[model samples]
Target: MKKTLICGALLVFVQQMNLVQAQDWKPVEGKIMTEWTEKVTPENAHQEYPRPQMTRDNWVNLNGLWDYAIQAKGAAAPSNFEGEILVPFAVESALSGVGKTVGKDQELWYNTEFASPKKSIKDHVILHFGASDWETEVFVNGVSVGIHRGGYDPFEFDITSALKSGKSQVLQVRVWDPSDDGPQPRGKQVNNPSGIWYTPVTGIWQTVWMETVPSSYIAGIRNASDLESKQILVTPQVTAAQAGQQVKVSAWKDGNMLAEQTIDPNGTAKLTIANAEFWEPGNPVLYDLKVELISGKKVLDEVGSYAAIREIKMAPDAEGIQRMMLNGKFLFQYGPLDQGWWPDGLYTAPSEEALVFDIQKTQDMGFNMIRKHVKVEPARWYYACDKMGMLVWQDMPSGDMGNGWEMKVGVLGSQTDRARTPESEAIYRTEWKEIMDDFYSFPSIVVWVPFNEAWGQFKTKEITEWTENHDPSRLVNSASGGNFEMEGTKITGDIIDLHNYPDAKMPDPGIFGKENIIVLGEFGGLGLPVDGHVWQQKDNWGYQSFKNEEELLNRYAGLMKRLEELISDGLSAAVYTQTTDVEVETNGLMTYDRKVIKMKAAQLKPLHDKLYQVSVK
Candidate 1:
């Protein structure tokens, strides 16, 4: 009894010491932080399951404090680490606990230790990264596992072969990002961030986790739901399949199973529902899905997923003007241009609640759609949109700027495409395809925007056509207020979008409305910076600066009133300047820290309601 008491006391002492060590970490000071910042700690930093579309019950979140080091671009891994930086947050972000920059000439390295999660010889361990910047290489127990190049897409490595027979395993990551120094699709990152540009995010900026699966498992799932046919095509990508292996898919609603089908491991399962509930704004209905891999009578792997039945297309109204249609009806889509940046986390939100806060606030303001401007978000962001019934227009992050913009309305072939080198073109194509393929399963994504304002705009006709052909289910907006390539009577893509500031406007309905859907891609950048909730104290900016909330709301009301008129004039959709203030750009519906909503949702929803009432004829 005395020995048992002594062991219990020692266990409590070690627990207290671990608590003290975790408390030693702190966020870098001197920056505007959100309410969720305080909730973030080394022990709990985005501990939610990273992937929602394809999920398994058993997995481990690798988010927390990790040893970090910055060395020269070509230098070897450092023998000594600088300090403990929070995982999943970029090194330059305040939430990282190391607000230091890793430029083009330097490489950032991360080291961590995790216990081996192997249960048997047939188990294969996979390390998954939600996203990493530019270039990244992973090492398991000092063994090079894999190298991946792409800043926005998720990648994984099978580390089963690299594991050793031990309880603890070492994991190391090396990352190098040439932000603006290279010709990659870096969005708005610049070496000298000023004006519209913001800080650079290097290293991992998303969740890192691991899971053990059977040697042959379901690698991915693709759902193509057709509202017209009342059928959903389920395609499961299996990593390793034997001759007699088969896959089973079942769709459920509430607690009842609706449909089930089994097909060859390599085939697509087509399940038809007698009466399907359509997914749309204000009433997003998602059906649960269960996929199982089986060989004869034994089940190999099973995963939980979900799908929504919806469709978006363009059709002419009574006046022969093209209008964007959702679920066979015309609905004027309106939302903010969400940049997906956080004051504390930069590319990564402080927490999952913080990530969903922006979307909730936007929806509160009566917005139905969001133009996810240049930067892509973590998968959970889209998952929230799917659950909350918010439509998304995703953009390919722009890079290789300084390619002149000289397009004019009512002119054909007014601007020439930027002449990018072979290397630059290849990088853009590879990443864009990966982004589309990786994000194709989300039902909320209705439009795919390939270029924005002629920034790195090249081969407009070819790129737009490829995007449309690749994903015929989603409409293609060739360029949002960028150069237009007129082929015959219409623009290259389905939408002819225009971007005007401080006021609501649209592409000439008389000119482009008949051939394509006309939209005010961006407008009403009314800026009102709250006193204590800004990234910087001085020199804040907006397309149209406002003195106070009353002035901003009054001006915004005027813009909405005009937007209502344009809806009747063949305007199918519109996107406001932004959902939140980013860095020095003060033209947001909410302040940067999200502490203050510049204009209350109660006031904005009524004005937005009037826009939806306007006829599209």
Candidate 2:
């Protein structure tokens, strides 16, 4: 009888261990956190579908606790984990529950177990990662699946063959990020962060998930909208082509079919919507898309998608000066320079709601545009802008700061091109192409700012021309606030941009007005620090500091009052200092914790509307 009791006790212990592993986890307390941090638990952390552009109803989110270990480079995966670190948050971030830094000589390892999705031999299981910093390799059930190199773009691996014959399967990943030590596009991340630079993000900093698909399925789709043509150019990519297979694309509005077309996988079909309403800033209209892979009337696979019809261009106005036109109308674009960094999550936002808050508040302030500075945000951020009718100017994150910088006030000056190694150039080219392709479908992104203030600027004429050829639909600002490379008084790209601090200013239209659209790329870094919301107690900095909200607003109003004169001269768009305070930079309109809005939305909206009214006749 005693032996029987002992056996039962052992069985109970095993059950309790399983229960402990499955319990929901909470975010570790950080030095400074957002309000959303309180709501972040394992069960509800980043629960929303990561990919809003091309989505499938059937998928699993792997964004909770995972066994993590830090080891020397080239070391084998550890058999025992050091501790539990939250997925989708970098190890150095506070929300990860593991505030540790993995240097260039170390590798960050992650291990997790998930159930195999019900599938047949003809079906495949695809493991998807929203993003992982630097170099990453994945393994399923101890079998090496694939490896991805870029840190900013999404990638996936088909692990159908590596699945084990059980309910649970083992998955492992290894990541290495050299940050600024390497020539890769590390953005503002550095080993030791201060000033404009911040902490390094080494490992997975985005959603991890999996989905099941047929052997022959829809691989991807691209949306190109032409407002003048009243049509959407959709091209679908198929995984495995079959005999008599065709790609069918349908556009729906409020459940009513507006247009449909079936074309070959390699062909682009124009889905025409009769009398299509243009997608504008206030009325952001979106059409639902349904794509199907069909084989002789049999639907092999299907996916849900969305699209926005809008056009961005530049043309000569009545005064013969180049002006930015949205659907052939002059609209002055203005907003904060969005750095896209979070104090709690570092590279990642604490949650989707938190991600939307910044965009929504920008719109509420009556600004029509946002300049997404250096760092790239998750796809959902652009999707939010699309829904809210906020225009975006996306910047390619800068790296390789070893180049020489030559600033020109207004004239075309000598360019100091960085002679990057072949490997470094290849890395930049590959990542830039991927970023453009991944974000091409988002109609909100009207401008692509390839370089910011000459940070790692190189191959000026060649890069600008290449970008124009790659995406002719949108105007390219080759280098915003970059070193001006002039060819007989003519600039290379579409716009001539300038950067001035603490107040409003613009590039001299007399030199650049006839050829390129002139813009104020950055200005008005008015700062106000609130107690208990700062990243640090001392050493906070900004271009101009204020003692209270009234003083800050009065200073901002003065800058706006000066900006009207520049607009009359020929400024097309302008970007303010930033959206929120970051690290030691207290120039943000809001505090780092996002707890206080120094300038009220109601007060700023009218002031912003007056700037838009000063357009050239």
Candidate 3:
């Protein structure tokens, strides 16, 4: 009895000491922070399930504080770390607790310890990284596991073989991101952030997790719904499938099974729904999915998923003008150019609630679509949009800027595609494809934008055609206000987009509306910088600066009035300047910290409603 009591006391003491150590960490000071910043702690940084689309009960979130070190580029991993940083937040961010820059000449290293999750010999442990900037290498138990290159796509490594027989296992990560020094697709990261560009984010900026699975498990899930046939096509990528193994997919609605189909593990299963509900703005209907890997009479692995039925295309209206169609009907898509940056967490949001807050606020303003400008967001962001019924126009993060661009008002520019080295071209291709494949399952994504404003606009014809052919389900906006490549009568892609500031403008309906969908890609950048909610106090500027909210609203209403006329002429869609202020750009519906909505949703929603009512013809 005495020994047991002493053991219990010692365990309690150790746990108390651990709690004290965790409490020692705090967010770095001297920056604008969101409301969710206070909710972030080492114990609960991002405890939500990282991947919601394909969910399994057996997994562990590897967030919270981890030992971090900054060393010179190409240097070996350090034996000891400098300090603790909050996981999933970049080192350059205030939420990281060690807000410091890791430049192109340096590398960031992370170290953590987790208990082994394997219960049997047949179990394979997978180390998953939601995303890491640039190049990342992993080591498990001091053994090199794998290396992944890409700033936005998720990657995993099977570390089962590297694990030793122990209760605690060591995990280490090394990351190198050449923000602007290299030709990688880094979006707006710059060594010297000023004006429109923002700070560089290095190291892990997304969730890190681990899961144990059977030898043969479902590695990936690809879902697409056919509105015409009322069928849901499910393709399960099974890893190490045995001969005779099969996949069973079942679609359910409101806890009731709608349809089920069993097929070979390698093939696609088409489950036909009797009464299909289409997914659209204000009427988002998602059907639950259950996938099981079966071998004979035994079930190997099962996962929970979801799908939505929707279609996006372009069709000519009665006036012979191409109009964007949603679910076989013309709907003018309007939203803001969302940068997906946070004042507290540069790339990652302070918390999941904070991540969804921006989307919710945008929706409250009566916007149906969001042009995810340049930077890609975490998977949960898209999942939230899917649930909230928000349309997404995803853009490939631009890199290798300084390409010559000749801006023309209503005609094609004389400048051809940018001449990029083979290395730069390969990097762009590899990452773009991975990004598309990673986010293909999300039904919220309606458009794929390859280039924006001629930033790194290379191989326009080839890249746009590849993107269109790769995913025929979503419409491809080859270039959003970028250099256009003419092919006979029409532009290279489906949409001919134009970008104008302060005032709404559209492509000439008489010139290109007959061949492609015309859109105002960006406008209405009226700046209103709230004093306490800004990243910096001085030199903040917008395309059109407004001293007060009333003036901003008046200007915005005028732009909307003109936009309604354009929609009547042939404009299919439009994206406002932005959802939130970013860095030095003060033009946003909300401030940088998101504490103040510059214009109330109630006031903006009524004005935005009038745009939707305008006819597309």
Q: lDDT of candidate 1 vs native? A: 0.91
lDDT of each: 0.91, 0.87, 0.91
lDDT of 3 at 109: 94
Model 2 regions more than 4 Å off: 1-26, 409-415
How good is model 1 by TM-score?
A: 0.97
- List pairs with backbone clashes in candidate 3: none
Q: How far is candidate 3 from the true structure (C-alpha RMSD, Å)?
A: 1.3
lDDT of candidate 1 at residue 397, scale 0 to 100:
95
Which of 2 and 3 is ahead in lDDT?
Answer: 3
Q: Each model's TM-score, in the order given? A: 0.97, 0.96, 0.98
Clash count list over all predictions = 0, 0, 0
Clashes of 1: 0
Q: Write out the backbone clash pairs for model 2.
A: none
- Model 3 residue 612 lDDT? 87
